[model samples]
Target: MPRPLMHRRHVLQGGIGIAAWLMQPGARAQVAAEPAGASAADFWRLARAGGCVFLMRHGATEAGLGDPPGFRLDDCRTQRNLSEAGRAASRQLGLRFRDEGVRLSAVYSSAWCRCLDTARLAFDPHYPAHQIWPALNSFFQGQGDAAAQTREVLQRAATLHPPDNWMLVTHQVNITALTGAFPAMGEVFLTRADPQRPDRLSLLARLPA
Candidate 1:
């Protein structure tokens, strides 16, 4: 099932709402006991500031990892596709972006169907989005060049400026390679390359869908 999404106003308002509570008695213990909130606000602030890329681990998929043996990119049937729930999540993700007024300048995705579908549903750009960028492809099956892909992504991101944000929908390994952050299925990360060292990416925040 799709989890409930928060309104944009609520998130920005709560961005720093709980800071003082941590300093009070039993605060650490009490705070430790609280459930985590899925925040969608922080990333927008950085995204609007630009020079960043949004890396999304494709939405949930059918059982099994990587791809079924001998899966072909040309046929979605050959690959593990998105589950119904994943589809729903993707649509909600789009709504979240729309609500937050985050317009993607470019949408890139892995050739794999699950990744493709996730981006297709989330952004739904005119005539779909990019025609698949190999750099966004999954390297989990010992197939892709992680170093090369990461470099390409970093190089592309370097050209972004304020009001320009690109979205990359890919597999877990691809995202992990670029940001060193393990994203949950369907989760998004807002990241920017280090100013001095463009090779390394700094995670700004995790944007929940």
Candidate 2:
């Protein structure tokens, strides 16, 4: 059977978390594509006001899942990297944040090259590279500790105060584990560390890739 067509706009609700997927026109973006509305403004407001962590999946990859056999973490040549379109999306993401005057206290990336490249490409051309956190690394292939890493993200997020926002450039698996929102490459999810619930993050809104 043919797969069902995806809706351009929709809402997924659960517990105290509410995710409004707003897709912008001409935007290679998130879960659902829609014309921007009040959600976009509110998302930016939260970002600028700080006290939030933006979870970003790395820019689009060349192709394929996980890494090839015998791939090494230190070698980009051995892994799946970003494509031209992905690079363009990444650059646009950084520009969007800059144009909005949003301030991020820290920008972290997974040790993976794709994640690192997304961080460096976005925000600024000379983004001073990245601060690699193993906790944000991909466990997609079942090679890392999902439960432990998720805890680390929640713990760190709880420490962030308002006016001190943060960004974590990580993989799809990591983001899903934290918020249960599977995102597109270069997609950004506005989330806050839920101290009361160490097991989850509060999803505010989602931005396109």
lDDT to native, each model: 0.71, 0.75
List TM-scores for all candidates, in order: 0.77, 0.80
Residue by residue across 119-146, what tens digits does model 1's lDDT show?
Answer: 8888874323655888888767457776
Top-TM-score candidate index = 2
Cα distance off (Å), candidate 1, residue 59? 0.4
Kindly list the per-residue Cα lDDT of model 2 for residues 108-140, writing each as its tens digit: 989998998889889645334468899999876
Evaluate residue 103 in candidate 1 and report its C-alpha lDDT on the 0 to 100 scale. 63
Query: Against the true structure, what is every candidate's RMSD?
Result: 10.7, 9.0
